[model samples]
Target chain A: MRRFSAYEWVRTAVTIGIALALGYLVLVFTVDDPNGAFKWFLWGPLSRMRRIVELIDYTIPLIFAGLAVSIVFQAEIFNIGAEGQLFMGAVGATFAALYFPQIPVIHVILVAAFAMLVGGAWASIPAYMKAKWNASELVSSLMMNYVAFFLGLYFINYHMRDLKAGYLVSYKFPETAWLPRILKRYNLHAGVFIAVGFVFLVWFFLYRTRFGYEIRMMGFNKNFAMFSGIKVNNVVLYAQIVSGMVAGLAGAVELMGLYKRFVWQVSPGYGFDGIIVALLARNNPLLVLPAAFLVGYFRTGAYVMSRMTGIAPEIVTTLQAVIILLITAEAFLEFWKRRKIIREAMKAEGGDVQ
Target chain B: MNEIARSILSAEFVYSVIRVSTPLIFAVMGALLSEIAGVINIALEGMMLMAAFWGVIVSAFTGSAWLGMLAGLASAVLLALALAYFHLNLRTNLILAGIALNLFASGATVFLLYLISGDKGSSASIKSYVLPRVDIPLLKDIPFFGDALSGHHILTYLAFAAVVFVQYLIYRTPLGLRLRAVGENPEAAESVGISVRRVRYIALVLSGLMAGFGGVFLSMGYVSWFARDMTSGRGFIALAAQALGGKTAIGGMLGAMLFGLAEALSYTFQAIRIPSEFTNMMPFVFTLIALAVYARSVIARHRKAPSSSQPLEENTET
Candidate 1:
C-alpha cells in the first residue's frame, strides 16, 4: 500500500474546504434563507434516522456503480455506458421478476443473473469494437447509452406499462421478487450488505488476483503489457464485461430494493454520479463505499434543503461539478509541492555549497 | 403509402431536413476544428446549452436577435477557453473536465432560468426575439429547388456558408497548416518554433464560436425559445458526424446532413404508426453503424496496402 503524506492530506482538505465555501457563497446569494439552507446542506441527512436510512439506501447502488466505473477505468477503457448498462439490467431484472413470480429464492437469483447477462451483453458491443477496430470506447459507450435508454423505454411503454397507474411505469413485481428491507421503518434494504460485500470482493479482485495485476499492468502501459504477453484485448474485453455486470447488478438492486415497479425513469444520473464517486475515491474500491456515502449524504441533504428553502436541488449538481473541476485540476497544488521539494533538498544540502 | 410517399417527396420535407440539419452542421464543423487541433471538445454540449440559455434570455431582454447571438457566441467562447485552460494548462483530464463542464452547464442553465424567468422547464415566459429568415431573390424563382432552399433562418444559410469557410480555412490557410501540424506532431511543430498551445487555443475558440451559432439557432430560430437540455444529444451526434466525416469540414457537413435526414425521418415516422421511442433511437443507431462502417473501411484500406505507408494514416489516430 502507498502512504499519503501530510501535504497531500492538507491539500485535499483545503480543496474540499474551498469547494464548500464557494457552494455556500452561491447559496447565500441565491437562497432567501441562507443560514437554513447552509444548515440543511451540512446536516440535514443526519438530522433524522429516516433521512439517514434513506441516505444509506441511496449509497448502496452508488457503491456498485462506482466500483463498475473504477474497474473499467483501471483497465484504461473509457466506458461511459454504465448508465445504459444499468438500464438494461433493470429491464432484464424486471422481465425475470414479472415472469417468474413463484419460487422466491430462485426468482431472485434468476433476476440477478439476467441483469448481469444483459448488462454484460450491452457493454460487450463497445468492448468488441475497441478490441477489434480500436474504435473509441467513449463514443461507442455514449452512443449505446441512448440506444439502451430508448430500448428500456420501449419495453416499459409497450410491454410492461401499467395502464392503471396513470403514468408510464411497469407492472409491479410480485412480493416474492422484492428484496427484504433491512430496516422495518426506513427504506434500507439487504442491498446495502451486498454493496459492502462487493466492495471487499472488488478490492480482492483488483489487487490480489493475477488477472487484477494484469489489468493494472495493461492500464499502466498497454504496449508493455502487450509485449509481456498479457493478452491486452482479452483483458480489456473482460474488464468491460465485468464492469457492466456490476453496473447491471446495481440497477437490479435499486429496482428490487426500492421500487415495487420498474419506474420509467430508473436512473437519476446514477451512472454519472458514479464517475464523481470513483474520482473522489481516487479509483480505489475500498474508498468507494465512504465516497459514495458522502455523495449520498450530500444528495439527501440537498433534497431536504431544496424542499425547505425552495432552492433548486440542482445546487448540489453545481457543487459537484465545481468539486470535480477543482479536484481534477493537476496544477491545483503543484507549485506548493514543488516548493516543498525544493525546501527539503536545500535543507539536506545545508552548509555544503560546492 | 401514397400519402407517405408524397410527403416524403415534397419540398417542405426537404426544407425541414435542411432546417433540422443547420444546427448540426455548425456543431459538426466545430467538432471538426477541435478534433483536427488535437483537442476533443466534448464540452460542445455544455457550450451549446449555455449559449442556448443565454441567447434566449438576452434576446428576451434586449429584443434583438443579433445581440442575443453575440451574447451566445461570447458565452460559448468563454466556456471553450475555460476548457482549453483546464485541459491544456492546468493538465486536467480532458474528458473528465468536459463531463464536469457539461454537468455544470446542465445545472447552471436551469438554475439561471429559474432565477430569471422563474421557470425551470423553459424560457417561454419571456418573449425572446426570433431570428429573421432570408429568401434568396433569384433562387426563389426556381420551382422545386426554391421551396427547399429558400426562406430559411439567416443562421441556416450561414451554417452552409460556414461549411465552405471552414473547408477553406482548414485546407488553404497558414493557420490551418500550423494547427494541423501542432495536432499531428506537436514535438516536430515545437522544434520548428510553433506554439502548440496557442494553436490549440485558437482552434478551440473558433470551434466554440461555431458551436455558439448552433446554440443560438436552436433557441432563436429552431424554436424561438430555450428549454432545459434543448440541444439534447445533438452535440454527441456532431462528434459522431465528425468521426464519420473523417474530420474534414465537407465530410462533416455531409455526415451532419445524413444524421439530420435520419432525424427528419424520425419526425415523419412519428406521424405514422411507428413508436416514437424507436424513431428517437434512429440517429444514434445510425451513428454507430456509420462509425463501424467507417472504421471497417479504413481497416480494409490499410490491409489492402500493407507495405505502403500513407500520409493520411496519422489522421486516423482519433
Candidate 2:
C-alpha cells in the first residue's frame, strides 16, 4: 500500500476545503438555515439504524462497478461502457427472472449468469471498435451509454411495463428469484457477500496472474508491452469483457436485492459513480471497498439531508468533481510547496554553518 | 411512405431543420477547432450547459440580452481555461478532466437553478429576453427560400456566418498554421519556436467561445428558458460530427446538419406513432458508427504511409 505523505495529506485537506466552501456557499445563498442543513448533511445518515443499513446496501453495487472500472483502468483505456452494460445486465436479469422460474439459489445464479453475459456483450461493442480500429473508447462508450439508456426505456415501456401497475414498472420477480435479504429491515442482501468475495477475487487475479501482468504492462506503456511480446489487442478485449461482466452483475444484484419491481425510468448512475470509486482507490481493486464506502456514505448523507431539510442533494456532485480535479492534478500546488521546502532547507544549512 | 414525404417536403420542415441544427452547427464548429488543435474538447457539453444556465440567469436578472450572451461566453471560456490548466499544466488526463468538468456543470447548474428559482428542473419562473431575428430584404421576398432562411433567430444567422468566418481563419492565417502544426507535430512546432501550449490554449478558448454561442441560443432563442440537460448529448454528437467531417469546418457543418435532420425526422415522425426514445437514440448510435468508420479510414491511411510510426494521439490507444 502506498503511504500518504504530507503532500498527499495537504492535497486531500485542501481539496475537501475547496469543495466544502463551494457547497457551503450554495447553501448560504439558498437555504435559510445553512448551518442546520450542514449539520444534517454531516450527521443525518448515522442518526438512524435504518439509514445505516440502507447506506451499506447502496455500497454493494458501487463495489461491483468500482471493480469493473478498476479492471479497465489496468489497460489504460477509458471504456466507460459499464453504464450501458449495467443497463443491459439488469435487462438480462429481468429476462431470466420473468421467464426461468427455478429452485432456490439456482434461479438467482441463472439470472446472474445471463446478466453477466449481456453486460459483457454490451461492452464488446466499444471494445471491438477500440481493438479493431483504434477508435476512441471515450467517445464510443459515451455514445453507447445513451443508446443503452433509451434501449432500456423502450424495453420497460414496451415489453415489460406492467399495464395495470398505474406507472411504468415491471412485473414483480418471483420469490425464488429474490436475492435473499440478509436483514429484515432496510436492505441486507446476499449481494454483500458476493461483493466482498469479488474484491478479493479481483485482487488475486490482478496480482497473481499472468493476464494481470499483461494488463498492467499495457497500461504502463503500450509500446513497451508490444515490445515485450504482449498481444495488446487481445488484452484490451479480454479486460473489457471481464470488466463488463462485473458491471452487469452489479445491475442484476441491485435489481434483485432492492425492489420488488423494476421502476427505473431513468437508468441508475452507479456506473459513472464507479469512476469516482476507482479513482479514489487509485484504480486498485483491493482498495475499492473503502472508496465505495466513502462515496456511499456521502450519497447516503445527501439522501438523508434532502429527505429532512428539503435541500437538494446535487451539491455532492460539485464536490465529487472538485475532488476528481484535485486528485488527478499531478502538479497541483507542487511548485509552490517545493520552492518553500527548498528555501527552508537552505536556511537550515546556513544556520548550521554559522 | 406518402406521409413521410408530405411531412418532410414542406417549407416548414426546412425551417425546423435549420432551427434544430443551429445549435449543433455552432457546437460542431467548436469541436472542429479543438480537434484541429489536437485537443478533443469533450467538455463541450458541460460548457454549453453552463453557458445556457448563465445566459438565462443573467438575461433574466439584468434585463439585457447582450449582457447575457457575454456572460454565457465568459463562463464557458473560463471553464475551458480551467480544463486547459488541469490538462496542460497540472498534468491531469484530458478525458478525465473533461468528464469531471461536465459533471461539475451538470451538478452546479442544477444547484444554482434550484437556489435561484427554488426549482431544480427549469428556470421558467424568471422572465428572460430573447434575441431578435433579421429578415434579409431580398431573401424574405423569395417565398420558400425566404420562409426557410429569413427572419430566423439572430444566433442562427451568426451560426452560418461563423462557419464561413472559421473556415477563413483556419485556412488563411498564421495562427491557423500554428494551431495545425501544434496538433500535427507538437515537438516539431516547439522546436520551431511555436509555443505548442499557447497555440492549444488559443484553440481551446476559441472552441469555448463558439460553443458558448450555441448554448446561449438554446436558452434565449430556442425557448426563453433553461432546462436541465437540455443540450441532451448534442456535445457528444458534435464530437461525432467532427470525426465524420475528418476535423474540418465545412465537413463538420454538413455532419451536424445530417444529425440535425435526424433530430428533425424524429420530431416530425412522432406524429405518426414513432417513439421519441428511438429517435433520440439515432444521433448517438450514428456517432458510434461514424467514429468506427472514421478511425478505420485513419488507420488504413496510416498503414500506407512511408514512416508508419506516428501515433494518432499521445498516450491514447497508440
Candidate 3:
C-alpha cells in the first residue's frame, strides 16, 4: 500500500487500451477494407503537407473554443453556452460583413472585434447572474445555446437572407471582408496565428497574473477565496466573460475564414466539444494545444473515414464522450480506493506516526 | 401598448402556457428528485431525447402509445443506472457523467434512427400511435380553469399528479427523508446507518423515470414523431426551473409553469406578428433577468444576515 500499486497503473492502461480497441472495432465493422481503413484513420492525415495545413485551418476555431472553455473551467464555471456565444459572434460578424461590406479593410477588423464584444456580452448576462444570484450557469448557459440557435436562424432567414439565392442563407460576403488566407495555396487564414497568440496570452494570464491566481483560488474554494478577500463573484464573472470573448472570436474566424456566406442553421456544437477538450487538457492552457489537435485530427479524419468507410462522422463524437468520461472518472475513484486501503492498512498497523 | 396587453392576456396565451409547461413539469420534477439526493443530473436533455426517440419507435412497433410511454421509461432507467452507478461507486463528476450520457444518447439515438429508417432528420414517416387525450367531463363544468384542464393529453394530468406526488414523497415519507438527508449532508447520513450511495441511486433512477415520461409525452402526446434532438432546450429550462424553485417540489412546479407560460407566449406572440425567434428567446431572457433579480435579493438578504448552508459551500462538497 505504501508504493503505487500495479493494479492502479493497469486500470489506467486498460481504459486507454479499451478505447483503442473500440475505435478499431468500429473501423473493422463499418469499413469495406478494415486493414486499409486502419491506416487512413491513424495515418492518412499525416500523408501530405496540404492535409497538415488543412488540419491547422480546421484546428483554429477548436483551439479558441478550447481556450475559452479552459479559462471558464479554471474559475469553476461550466459555461455550456460556448455554442450559443459562438453563434452570436457569427451572427454579429455576418451582419457586419453583409451591411458594412463597403467599409475599409482595416475597419473589418473592428467589425470582427465588435462580434467578439457582442458575443462576450451575450455570455456575460448568464455569468453575471450566476455570480450575483447563485444561479446555475450550466443550466442558464445551455438554455442560451438554443436561444442563440433560433436567433441565428431568424437572422439568416429574414435580415441577411439573399433574395437572389433560392436558399435561406445570407448574401455572399464581399472578398474584402473575408479574412486573408495566409497561405495562398491553402485555406489557412490569419485565424491560426490569432488562435496561437490567444493560447500564449491565456497561459500567461492563468499562470502568471494575479487575476489568474484569483480564478484558480476561486475555482478550488470560492468561500476560502472570499474569506481571503478575493472577490469570488468578480473572478468567476471575468473568467466566463473572457471565455465567451475567445469563443465568440472563434465564431467570427469560422465565418470569415471558411465561409463565403453565413449558412449555419445552428452552432456546430464547437462549444460543447470545447468542454471535452478542456477536460482532456485538465484545464491547462498550454495542454490545450495537444488536446485541441487530437480533437481536430479526429474531426478531420472522421469526415474522410465516413467517406471511405461509410461510418457516420459522429463516431468521433462518441470517442470524445468516452474520453471525457474516462478522464473525469479516473482521478477521483483512484483517490477514493487508495485512501480506503490506506486507512484499513494503517488501522492494522496501529496507526503510528512516520 | 394596448395590442401588447391584449396579446399578453389572450386565451391563446394560456394555451401556450399549458403546452410549454407540460414538458417543463416532467423535467423539473426529474431534476428535483436527483438534486435533492445529491446528484446533479444534467443529462435531462439526453434522457428526454432518447425517450422521445424510443417513445416514437416503440409506438410504431406496438401500435399503442402506452407501450411507447413504458419503453421511454425503460430506456431512461437504463441510462439512470449507468449514471447513478458511475457517479456513486466510481466517484465520477456527476455533471461530466451527465454530459457523457447526453452525448452518448444523442449519437446513439441518431445512429439507431439511421439503422431503422435510413433517414437522418426525423422519424415522421414511421407509423406511430399518438397518446390519447383525456377529456375531463366534470372538470369542464368549471369556468376558466375547466378549459385549461379539459382536452389535455394524459401525460399533462400525470405531470400535475407528479408534483403532488413528489411533494408528499419528499416532505412526508421516510424514503424522502433519507434522500434529502443524503443530499443535505452525506457524511452525516452515512454515519446514521443510511446508505448514502443507495439513496442517490434510487433518486437517479426515479429522476430518469420521470424524465422518460416527459420524453414520451413529447412525441406521443404532442408531436407523434421524433425529430432529431426535439426535446431541444426544454430539459435545460427544466433545470433552470429547479434552480429558480430552490429545489422544492412546489417551487419547481411554479417555476416550470412560469417558463411554460413564457414559452407559450413566445409562440402566441408569433401569431400576433412578432418575430418567432425573438419570442422563442423570451423564456431564456426571462431566466437571465430572474437570475439577476434573484442574485440581488440574495445579496440583500446576505447583508441583513448570513444564511446557514451558504450557496457556495452547500453544493461544492462531493
Candidate 4:
C-alpha cells in the first residue's frame, strides 16, 4: 500500500471510530444487555451467509435508486422525488405483472421496461414543471411523493388488494414473471448483475459521452453552458426523466425479486435512502454501487442489532446520519485548519523549503 | 348539485377549512421567512416531522402540552442549526444538506419510536398531553363569526399574529431590509458590509421556530397524538405556497388559504360521488398548476424586462 498522509488516516480513523462509538452509546443506553448489543453491532450480520446474502439483496435496489438520484444531481437538478418515482415504478410494474399473468416470460421483461417508463413519465411531470414554470423541484417532486403514495394505497386498497392476505397487499404476481435467481438456494437474484451492469453503463455515459460532459458543464455553471450553446433546459428535463426511470426500474426489480405482491403503502424510506447514498458517494453514479451496498450493510446490521440486543434499529440510522454529516463537512474543515497550521509552521521555519 | 352547493357553504366545511389551515398557517409563515432570505428549505418537512414526533413523545413523558410544544420547538431549532451550519459555515450544497437532514429525520424518528414503544407505526401507546381549547367567553357571545373563530388552540391565534409579525419583519425593519438585500444580491449586500451568512442563519432559525410551532400544533392541539410521518406533506405544500405567493407574505397567506381550502374541500367532497383518491389529490394538483402559472408569469416578466437575468434564472426557475 502507498504511504498514507496523516490527514487521510485521521479522516478514515475518525469515520470508523465515530460510527462504532455512536453505535455503542446507543446500545449501552437503550439495550438491556449492553455488551451483547456491542457484540451484535459488530458481528451479528456476518454470523451467517444467509444474512450476508440478504444484505446483497437489499443493496440491489438501493444501488439502482442511488444511480437514479446521482444522475439528476449530476445535471444539477435536485430531484427529491426519487422515492415517489420508485413507488410509481412499483405500481406500474406490479400492475403489469398482475394484468398479464398469461404473458410469456419474454413479454414480462418488456412489461417491466414499460413500468419503468411509466415511472419516468410520472417523475417527468415535476421535471417539466420545474423546467417550464420555475416551480421548486424540491417541493413539487416531494408533493408527488405523497400523491404517488396515496395513489398506491388507493390501488392496493381498491383496485389490486389481495383479499387472502388480510392486509392491503396487492394480488400475487405470476411466478413465471419472478426474476430468476442467479445463485442456488439463495435469495440473491439476477437483479444484482443488472444493477452492477447499470453502474458501469452510467460511468461510461458520464465520463465518455459528450452529452454527459455537457450535463456536468451545465451543472457547474449554467451561464457558461448556455453561452457554449448547450440546451440547458432540455438536458435538465431529460436527466430528471432518466433519473426517475432508473429509480422506477429499481422498484420494479425489487418487487419482482422479493415480494410476490405489491404491499407497501409508503416507502420503507428507500427513495430517501438513495439520497444519502448519492451524497456519500459525492454524486458519482458508478460510486453509488459501493455506497448503496454500505448503506444496505448498515441497515441490515441495524435490524439485526435491534433483534439481538433489543436496541432500536434507529440507532443505525443515527449513526448513518452522523457519518454523512461528518463526511460532507470533513474535507473542508481539514483543508482550512491545515492551511492555517501550515501557514504558522512555515512562518516559524522562516519559509525554509522541505 | 344544488344540495351539494348548499352543503359546501355549511359551517362544517368552514370549520374543516379552519382545522386544516391551522398547521399550514404556521408552515407558510415559516417558509416565508426562509424564502425571503433565499434559503430553499426542503428540511421543513423533516423539521415538522421531528417536532411532531418529539412533541408527542415529550408530552407523554412530561404530561404537559406546554412542555411538548417547547420540545417541538427545541427539536426543530436544533435541526435548523444543522441546516444553517452546513449551508453557511461549511458552504456545502444547501439542497443536498436538506435531503440528508430529511432522511435522517424520517429514519431517526421511526427508529426512536420503535425503541420507545416497541411499535413502528404510531405513538398511540403514549398518553400524551393535548392542548386545551381556549374558549373566549366574551368573544363567543359576539355572535355568528365569534363563536366559530374564538375557541381554537392558542397556536391558531399565534399563527395569524405571525403573519402580521412576519410582514412587519419583512417590510418595516432595518434587519428585514438587510435580509432582503442579502437574499436579492448576496455579492452586492456583502459589498455594503452585510454578512450574507448571518442573515441566512437568522432566517433559517426563525423558520425553524415557525415550523416547530406547526409541529406542536399537530400533536398537541389538533390530533393530540402523533403518527409515523404525521406532518405528512404539509411542509412541501408550504414550500409550494411560498412559490405560489411570489415570495411575498400576503401571497404566502393567500396561497396557504387556497391549499387549506383544497384540503378542507377534499374532506367535504369525500362524502360526495367523487373518488376519494382524486379528491385527495386536488391540493397537489392545484399546486402543480399554480407552479406552472407562476412560471408563465416569470417568463412573461423576463420578456418584459430584457435587462434582468438574475430574476429570470433564480426566482423564476428555482
Candidate 1's C-alpha runs over 4 A off are: A1-8, A346-354, B306-318
Model 3, runs deviating above 4 Å: A1-17, A23-53, A99-105, A331-354, B1-16, B140-146, B308-313, B316-318
Pairs with backbone N, CA or C atoms under 3 Å apart (clashes), candidate 3: A133-B295
Which rank order by lDDT, best down to worst?
2, 1, 3, 4
TM-score of chain A of 2: 0.92
- The TM-score leader among the candidates is 1
> Tens digits of per-residue lDDT for model 2 on B142-247?
9889888888999999999989988888888999888888878888999999988889899999999988999999999999999988898888888878777755
**Model 3 over residues A172-291: C-alpha lDDT tens digits?**
888877887888887788888788888999999988899989988888888899999998888878888888888888888888888868878655888888887787677888878877
Q: For residues A161-188, could you state the per-residue lDDT of candidate 1 as single tens digits?
A: 8899988789998888788988777888
Write down the worst ten-residue block by lDDT for model 3 chain B: B308-317
lDDT of 4 at B11: 61
DockQ order of candidates, top first: 2, 1, 4, 3
What TM-score does each model's chain B reach against the true chain B?
Answer: 0.95, 0.94, 0.94, 0.94
lDDT (Cα, tens digit) per residue for candidate 2, span A6-101: 676677678767777877787887789999898877787788889888888989999999999999987888998788889889987887888896
Q: Where does model 2 sit among the CAPRI classes?
A: medium
Q: Name the regions of candidate 2 deviating beyond 4 angstroms.
A: A1-10, A333-354, B306-318
Clashing pairs in 2: A182-A188
Error of 1 at A91 (Å): 1.6
